[model samples]
Target: MAKTYHHPKHDIHEDAGSMRADTKSRTTKFTSRHMAVYQAAAAFAKPPSRAWRLVWSAVLSIVTIASATVAFADALAVPEYVGSARCADCHKDAYETWNKSHHALAWTAPTAGHVLGDFNQSSFTHKGVTTRFFREGEEFIIETDGPDRELTKYPVAGVAGVAPLQQYLLETEPGRLQSFDVVWDVEERRWYHLYPEQELRGGDAFHWTGPYKNWNGRCAECHATGFEKNYSPVNRTYASSQAEIGVGCESCHGPGEAHIAWADPALSYDAEDWRGLSSVGLTMDFGKNTEADIQQCATCHARREPFLDGNPLPGAPFHDSYRLSTLRPGMYHADGQILEEVYVYGSFLQSKMYAEGVGCINCHEAHSADLKADGNGVCTQCHSSAGNPEFPSLRLAEYDSPAHHFHPAGSSGAQCKSCHMIERTYMGIDGRRDHSFRVPRPDLSVSLRTPNACSDCHSDRSPAWAADAVAQWYPDGRHTQFHFAQVLSPARLNPDNARDDLVDLAIYDGLPGIVRASAIDLLSEIGDPEIAERTSALLTDPDPLVRAAAVRLQRGAQGSVAIQNLLPLLDDPSQSVRIAAAREFLNIRAVRLPSSVSQKLDRARNEWQQSLVAKSDFPEAHIVIAGIALATRQFEAAVAAFEEVVTLDPQHIDAWTMIARIHAALGNRETAIRVLDDAIKANPQDISLSLLRTDMLP
Candidate 1:
């Protein structure tokens, strides 16, 4: 019989700092790749030390570099820091400020020092069910659902900071994973689960051990340092690993090896050293030289997907590996004012600050997670009382007072962020605000029936009432007239009725590019020839995002004429648009292009070739382009593409399967069999690959 361990469900009070110190110091040695599986467990089980421990460890290791080098070589090991201690050494002011910021304590151990909630025996009710929070000895625990219908007790490993809702953590199995459940009333000193009533009453959608519970799949990458979620979906088990527990020094600074090398005074630092070590030493500068790096941070913080891994480096091309949120039905209102949890990255992308090359670091200090200057001071960096000639309305004295805001001077309502950057809560207690920096569009709220800032505070009032109030206060308010009224009008009726409006909106340059791109989607309901032709033109739009959107709309069109019109976009300058265009034109036969159009396509393809010349090291790009070639029946090109994919990402199962298929199609039976055999060697558990190999043996 398997030994089952039961955890007590109650609050555990202890010294969190000591606990974290122990966890960080305790290191485990393993003999195989399977050793990676126990890394998270080892990290979590030890106690944490002060930030100085990590700094001293790094310093000591550096001092005895020759001896440490032999030890590291023998173990194939890397050093782990508690957090950004080495960075703090150089950046004292920033480090001191960061110690007070939320990011430093984003995740902490459960103790009187870190745990801010009332954990004494208290019961709370929600949705007709009651749950209790109590202390059991020195450990925190929760009584919740097990695998079946049983109510079981589990240990609460951590607390999610001080807020209206504090969350508790539970370790499900040793060397496996930890889970989180909601806790309410951090300040009130009362404990209640986030959805205690619903969960206890059997109506909760997010239960323990659900799809969302597996932290490796859902949240580990973002929360922990150097996390590699080795989840085997078939086994339904996680073998996750990380360099360190919690977000540590290496999380943002790539790997520390090169930085360590450059930091040595004996070594002669060069240009490469400067480029690589730039992320170290700290300042408020985020070092987002390329659009991709800026957007890479945004992808995790923003709502996006991982299209491919290790292809485009962080800050290369966002769309190459991720698909950004567009104006979708549930995610946004028809006017795109962010109805759902779109996250800050996408919303910020649409802001004037982003357009002006003002990145996350311009306002936020990276290590400290605090503003570089106070609210008014930061705003005044660009906007002054003397007035910016480019932006005349940005006068500080005029815009700073209650006369312009129509609120009390020191009131919460008067803060620029409170009114413009309305907060949305995620994971029970984390309140994230939109960074779009848009004005209050009460008129749009009335038209689309979406929530506005005025009505959020004044819940009983209508949007029209709020609009009228704003109009009265600022007699010349621009938001009084809705810019997206026409788009919302047709969206209100039916998708079919708004087909023409949608098609027209796609190409309308006057509107925000995102808004127009969203409008093009409304045409999906209509099965007309004209709508297809209109969407085809968007394939050449100046914005790569718009062009990509057009390619998607065109693919759905299914008409031969539409396919022909989209073929030219296959060689688009933007890799995102080109990838989409290539995928769209896959099934269509090549049509004769006009000499001028052919020349344009050739030029675009040349641009794409130049871009790829340097990025040839990446396999996913080859795989994607190869898939396009395969779809177009260019078998040789497909084979070459698949070969590159397999070479770069040896773990890629799809590339191996395609290689087998391409070989079998060419009547190279032995080679096809060998290809599948190699795939099985890489991933022996892949039943599909095994079956395909067996079926191929003639």
Candidate 2:
């Protein structure tokens, strides 16, 4: 009998979050003279004589130069979306599906119909602290103990979601920024004070008005469309805005204007493939394409940083810009069960399915967020009973019954995922199941003391008993060794003695790239003279990742030999290796180099600067460059970079504080005072800013 596949059905009729009705009230005021100059420059750029072109170019350059001089200057104005009404005209099916999915209703407007929680004067206590949730006319209000036991009334700006915990948003800086308070009770269905013990001790991180209150920098990037945090560190304020309130049609499709023009039937989008286009509508063959695009989505969704923002340039690889979480300590347990806060993407990469080219879209439908097919149906798509002709040894029949599972047919224990994939809850209620999909190995579990599927089910039973049961079921079965399990023990126990073993593991070709990279990281901690020499030779390794690791581990080594070996890797094909080389070289400031090598290093630095120019709105990039400039004693460059950072992201209090220090160092006391005044206006309730101002006054 053929096994039937079961697809999980997901409701796709949910509403996308709330609309920002208050956006029209806030307007950015630019200087009249600057606007006039910009208009004149725009007019001069039109088709004209050679003399006129020269005049236009010069004027535009002047305008560009002047615009950077002024603080809080708005360049690109984001267009507002009317609503989902426009999208429904062309894509009715997709719109309907999105409405049903959780993406639509992730955040919602407060109303009698839409509001889920009990907001009518309710007090809830958690961890020995009390918080009251009440209503101020139509708006929801939360009253919690502020600094010195003072009761503070915070208005709920918006609701996060319906199920789980209904998180409330607080407007810390009115229109400019809003932040989510950390505490919410799922069982009592009420709001509670977060970090109650710390609050009682008078040292709470989430005291009403803190650095975390700048929601635009902390949260808006992931939630809204084209979000620019627009924080001014010098001013200590946020002037953040987005193109859209929630994820809209343009989020995935790129800008819709070009797409709309192409879709018109009158004008052929492509002259060559008109008939082919009519026959087959827009369909992307995800299976045929390389994993680059899929990896781009994974970059943000999987807990990685932005190397470049908006649209990444072609051939710019993922790992070059972002540092992925390795299977390191605190992230995973001894036998690879997730222990700390992992965002799934790292763990998923470890699976055999991912290595076999199975992507996120294979299991998950794009629009609906539902499983493409149910249960065994998804697994059998590639693994058929007829047998995989590519790998004939994968006979499906041997693994299809109670004999293999050692459990009765139709039982919960018989299900494949039940024994293999374990579910872990995060953020109190969000249950995420592991996707690594490894079979239960109780024998290894006993040796390593990692949790096994049998012990997970039979909580009272020991690993020894589980191993004996597995042996009884398959008497001749061999316990396969995990490479990580093998290397981890010696690496942790005797770091000094394990140098050679770690280096060998780092260069091992057959081992997984993640494991190899991890071994390299471990070796960096206790690497001696011999290991450093071995790592120096690896600067010429074919793989960029290994070569990059080699550069990182050999940072502190002196002498001309080490510096000469690393200079050539500055132009490596992989940006990761080049950046690594740059950082390593920058560390050894006094090391003399050949003029040509110095020139190559300068060229690499310019490339990094150019990359930053392309994504000027990214605050993190500015901060990194500013740190680099400060270290090099380029005080002017450092000040400029930090100023740009503050303008791009106002909620950066640390940046503002640093800018004031820089001004004071430069003997510009007036400028420092003005910067503080701006910061105080942005966050008037910030006690730290108040204290800083008092200290600076004298």
Candidate 3:
């Protein structure tokens, strides 16, 4: 029999815990004792091995959640997780098919076959630093700058990724893995550093030995299955662990123990057993071919923040486990085009394809995770003249024909991806295609300063020149009339002037959630007292991302009113909303919460701290910690956190400025001047830093 995704025989719709209005009774039942148990378990479960402590904490959290959850389905009695090796017994075809694929080789122990880079004392130089790769006995070694800026020999601990680029993991300390800044370009067959233009010396955040490169904090969760990022804020240590070291069978399929039991021929099973728990012992229900299937792949593919204790299971709701980043500046262009290394999910969510039910599996294989076809073949599956009848809304067009594309056959200009999905090179070498799948609009590009596919290929032509060419082709202005970038661009630059435009964009439900959320975020810059009520009311928005943005916008409102409006969100079902509410509420110092409300505020505050602690290695996370400390007048703590930020990112002018201010606050004028001088040296090109230093002169 051909394999099929398992679904419950009956259609049963279940709301997420926080979204269900009826679950208020269940939430009310959760007492102080329950909260105490959670705290006690976290406190007392600290075994020497942080790995074991995480396991204990997870088990306790699950138990507490199970007892209190009324919005979730009945718990599936799944057994313990079994390794991927066991799946080969019955699924030989799948096991073998995936064996040699990139997903299977995504991570591997350093060996003769797995190691791609040359190790015959080959040396590569970039930004005034030369790293030598050579073999020492049975181990691969690289002689590079260590944490203290001295030449040191480090053995290759593990290898991450394959094909386009491969990065080697080096063990800087026991149980701490750091990715080498330099990567081996597999196709090019040369070592290239991510930051080739700028010198990333030791102690810099971008350096391989620094915190941003720490595998445990930054990369392990997605690379491994059943991974636990066991970070301790007190000791500033990591005791991370995983069930399997690569993206194994369980990584996408979830645990296999119960699936193994169901496969047994000797076992007496009923209809319910065949239906077999949550999507066949997996956490996600994929049979419906819904958005959840794409979300499973998105868990690793997107730039997002985890909303819970550990990595969420497969098939979980995207918002339930992770809070997706909106089309925020610095990450995306004003017109919602990919501008940074945002992966795919954030961009895909904005496309019409996703809205029309186009999923990852439609273009890619389920097991091997390879594209079903190469290049235009993947798109032509649904976009050909015949078209996919499944989606009748998509008008049939002979996309492969010369009449449609208007370029010579087999030319790069004629390719569908060239016009629809432009590629942006990130990490210096890897070219990631934008998944928004938008039509090339040089017209909008001219007005918004966004990149257009036409200009990408036509190097000599300007956006206006390309726009004129497009006008001759289309003749009609219909295609260029509708664009979110026009309003978004002005709103980003001056929200005060674009008040009506931003408000219109925020309330426009027809637009993508990310775009709407971004508009809401932009409204925070508006100082209009008239818009206060409008922004505050968005706290009740259905989308968690919108609510999150609304909480930030409400920060400028009257303190008592802001606290009252945000108090209810402290107990919101979504972790992102709760944390945002807590953070914003705490910022309003004038409004003191009553004891009844303070209890919930305290728990939410702890969640905010944990979120920052988990990402402690990041300079941005340290900045947040510093901001919180400074807000509460914890000068010493704030100074230390800001100093840590400066240590990680030497050229961080904002952190340097904060550090100088903290010293000045403590009545040390000389120390403040010294800090400014150091910042000026690190960021010589920064006129702001130079000006600030001149102001600090005695």
Query: In lDDT terms, which candidate is top?
Result: 3
User: Which is the better candidate, 2 or 3, if ranked by TM-score?
Assistant: 3
Candidates' RMSD to native: 15.4, 12.1, 8.5
Q: Candidate 3, which ten residues in sequence have the lowest lDDT sum?
A: 10-19
Q: Write the per-residue lDDT of candidate 2 for residues 15-118, one digit (tens) a residue.
A: 00100000111112222323333344346444334432332232232123333233332333222333554568788999888766655555555565556666
TM-score of 3: 0.84
TM-score to native of every candidate shown = 0.64, 0.68, 0.84
Of candidate 1, the 10-residue stretch with the lowest lDDT total is 14-23
Off by over 4 Å in 3: 1-79, 265-279, 307-310, 589-599, 670-698
Off by over 4 Å in 2: 1-87, 107-114, 146-149, 175-203, 206-214, 266-290, 308-317, 383-395, 398-400, 474-478, 532-548, 556-577, 589-698
Residue-level lDDT tens digits of model 1 in 467-583? 999889877877745465456556645867767667777778766666776665555445566677666777778877787777656545555666566766755555556644534
Tell me the lDDT of model 1 at 27: 14
Model 3 C-alpha lDDT versus the unseen true structure: 0.71
Q: What is the RMSD, in Å, between candidate 3 and the native fold over all Cα?
A: 8.5
Best by TM-score: 3
